[model samples]
Target chain A: MKIEAMPAEKAARAGGRPGSEALQRRLAVAFAGALVVVTTLSLTVFETARRALASSRLVAHAHEVLQVMNGVEGTLVTAQSAVRGFVITGDEVYLRDRDSALLSLESGVQRLRDLTADNDSQRRRWQALRDRLDERVALLDRLVVIRQTEGAGRAREFLRSVYPPPPPAKTGRIRAITGEMAREEELQLAGRMREEELASAFAVASGVVLAVLFALMFTLGYLAIRRRVAQTFGLNAALLSRTEEAEAANRELEGFSYSVSHDLRSPLRAIDGFSRMLTEDYGERLDDEGRRRLAVVREGSQRMGRLIDDLLEFSRLGKKPLACSAIDMTALAGEVYRELRTADPEGSPAFDLAPLPKGWGDAAMLRQVLANLLSNALKYVRKDRAPRIEVRGWAEDGRNVYCVKDDGIGFDMAHYDKLFGVFQRLHSAEFPGTGVGLAIVQRIVTRHGGKVWAESKPDEGSSFYFSLPQAAMSGFTDPPAARGGRR
Target chain B: MNRSRNVLLVEDNPYDVELTLRAFEQNNIMNELVVVRDGKEALDYLFGAGAYAGRDLGDAPEVVLLDLKLPKIDGLEVLRRMRADERTRRQPVVVLTSSSEEKDVVSSYNLGANSFVRKPVDFTQFTEAAKQLGLYWLVLNEPPPGG
Candidate 1:
């Protein structure tokens, strides 16, 4: 049986799924961006609050200034009313009221000056208003003095003369200054109130935006985790079902092989046994052709028996549980060669065995593979000259590759497809084989998670190579046979 | 060699029975050999029941060469029945079959079979196995105390 060469599959590099990793990275970046936005918004909210505080203070200051201006206007009007009452009724209580009103007016103007001190324009207007208030209070006091000293008629005349309002110029100037100052404070108060409102709205908006961002981040993370879990479950379920199917198929195959081994061999035995009995007990009665036919029958039965045994061995190779061990390849090859040599003690093959590396595999299975390969090497040589065989091993690409090269009647590479098939014989007439040996070799190598292939040229030689994974070499003690040295 | 030794051969295949008888003749093992064709007949003969009811129970076979595959009942079931009965529990049974499967060998031993041998396809090998078996069981080894 010829085994066709199969290209080895390169091992896949170890890494997480590229798509999922990119998705995870993107999720991280998005989350980080969300946090940055939240942080920035939080700063915005805090700044708004600070601005609101400052604006609220400005509003309070504006209200205080307006209140102080109104106080000054109220004080001046009360002083004027008290002096008028004193001059008209000649009442002493009215005169005392005028004196107290003048004192209150003085203090009100002084307070207004202090409150408007931070504004240069307001301070100038306040100073002018203060001077006007002082002049108005002095004029009111003079009226009260006139009502007391010159008597009622003269006081009335004096008031009338001054009451023309000094052509409305000086008092107008005082009223205008106070009105302008009050207007300025009112404008500032309105501006500060608007700023407070805007700040409060910004604070609320930022809070809401930040809350939404947090919710979004949480939802995205939850979805990512949920999707990954669901994918894993789906994959696990598929793998579980596939494994069960494979196990069922394996069981069926084992049953078939068992029955084949038991039922088929019995008939073959009977045929061979009876044929031998016929020849032994009744050979004299048969003619030459008859005896030759009987011999043919025995030989046919024996060959069929051999075929059945080889078939059983091939099937059993698939089912046998491997007992793995560390193997010294050089010692193992020597052992197989010695055994093969013993089997054909009359024939000597020139063996060129190179230094072999240690390997990891089932010792018995490996022995079977080597024995078959070496036997093939010894079998297919020309009868005219001695057989030359080479054995070598090397480690490459995480595997140990061993090669058995023989100078024999090599097969055409075109027929390589028929190799390693059970019952496939390349040179059945020339080579005596059940055609299952290379098939058994293929089965054993595959079970070890390895591959087998060959390179050959007709009449030159054939080189058969098999490789075993390096990972299987560890965690095993060397076989006892290997330690016992060459037998 | 004991001339009075008796052997029971249980097999369903006629050709196999002939081949075995021929091998025994070739080996010159001349002890009296009784053949039963099936598991049921073998059970009946061993226990002296049915067609064997009139036979003396004390004249038990020294060894039973049991074949695994048979008609009516299988070898394992027959072995189970034999081991279960007090009358036949101590009788020596050697399983001789074509199957060399690990499960068959293990099951035969588990059912109290004394030995398991695969019937080699070669007649010469068969003759040798038969000779060894007869020399050991009927001639050399002592039977259990008569029931």
Candidate 2:
């Protein structure tokens, strides 16, 4: 059986989409929520501190008012005792004590006025207390003078006036005033105690609420971070699995390629060898028609050899690592053009070589790309007109832009999408290509992280452009002369 | 000078062996070509072991034509054993295989093979190659003296 070589398939596998956008959205929501929680917690803390400070101030004011009331009551009792002692003993010592008590009473009344500054009701009560104390003091002074001069009888009269065994109306009025003052003091103390209670309660509640809120915020923040880490781990695992699968597929393909090249070639060689032997041993006995048919078989086997060679070259490109370095665009283009000219020296084609920016790239691969483009341009030129080819380059937006323009049998814009695909051809077999040149160029460009495209119109002209990253330029230097010299 | 030289041909395929024998006849090598279908037979012929135990070890072939792929024992193992033995270390072993793989070529040279040649598919080319090789090894090239 005649063994026929099948061409290698060249379809690219599609890639999976990433979930970066969803992760970004979740991160943003988490950040905003954290900000709100922090703000609310801070405000609660501030209010709690303010209330604590206000309650302390109220406590201090209530204590001061209580001290003044105690001093006033003590002074009234001391003065009444001194006056009664003088009246009973008829002694100057008691009279002196009565005068000193009068001095203490006046000062106590002044202090009561100062301590009750915040309350109008307490102030009015203090004024009434002061008036009553002054009346008592005046009666005591008269009794003291009488005791010094008129003896017990006049002293007794003065004492009666000062002590006032009591007019019911006046006593009731004084008692009412004292009651009002006591009530006012009690009210002030009660108000201060209420504020303290409220402040304590508010502080405790705010502390509890803030603690819970902060804890919740912290927990949520931690959870968000953990989730993000988990998602990252998942993404990494998925990427790792994809990489492993691709590596496995690549290894399988390599094995298959080697087996095809080695095992398949052996049988093909036998077929070719045996067939040749038949023609050699029995040629004279055969007719011209038979010889022609045998020639067809030989030609078919040779075509199969060419197909195998092309397939091997295609797979080799995938496994081969690129050697990247700085490449002088102008020099590289000139070298390719020179080779094209030598291959078809008699064919008239005006060439325009422009000054080109240097770029980082693989020298051999770049040379291949340029050779393919120039040869294609030369092959497709209009039959009537002389071929014209132009090569130019420049830096734009931190990238190197290279273009090859030609006056040729340009293709329709509708078929532009098919140009870079493997085995996709617009021209007939007569043009003499395996329809793999452009596809190879695209693969090399993509490996370099660059983009390539073409613009053309039928029967007019075509221009191919490609862009490469500027950063790649620093490592690669152009070969002073093309390595494989002009063809 | 006219003494017929002994040649050992190690190959698996009968067709390839037939073609090689025809090539040798057409080229007038005038040598007693010894055929070994696999590496085991080749080893037996060289070492005088197994079925060839009664043969003289000193009467080794002038040249051993080795094929890389064989059924019982591979050609590389046979070549390795030949190079290791003092009695047959200097024996001329030529690699004649269908594969032009770089690894095979490199390995044959590394293992002390006297020469390496890929068998051409075309009958005419194969015959021409055999003629040149026969002249070079059997007629022109000198063999090492028996130990």
Model 2's alpha-carbon lDDT is 0.75
Candidate 2 lDDT over B55-125, as tens digits, reads 87777788999998888898898999889998779989999986655667889999999999877655667
**CA shift at B121, candidate 2, in angstroms?**
11
TM-scores for chain A over all candidates: 0.59, 0.60
Compute each candidate's TM-score over C-alphas. 0.66, 0.54
Model no. 1, DockQ:
0.60
Where does model 1 exceed 4 Å of error? A1-19, A22-217, A457-460, A474-487, B1-4, B54-58, B85-87, B140-147
Model 1, A1-487: lDDT tens per residue?
A: 1112211211122134446777788679768867887788778877887887788788778787778777777777777778778888988898678778778878888888788888999988877776777677777768777778889898788867876664245456677888898898988788778867877887788778877887787678778767777766765665556566667877887788778877888888888898888888898999999999988988787778888889988877877888877788898898899888987876677898998878777888998999999999999997878899999999999999999999998899999988889999999666888899999999999989999999999899899999999887766655554642343
RMSD of each: 9.9, 10.1
The list of candidate 2 runs beyond 4 A from truth reads: A1-60, A79-108, A135-157, A164-179, A188-247, A261-309, A316-327, A336-351, A357-364, A375-389, A393-435, A446-487, B1-147
TM-score of candidate 2's A chain against the true A chain: 0.60
Real contacts recovered, all predictions: 0.79, 0.21
For each candidate, how many residue pairs have backbone atoms clashing (under 3 Å)? 3, 5
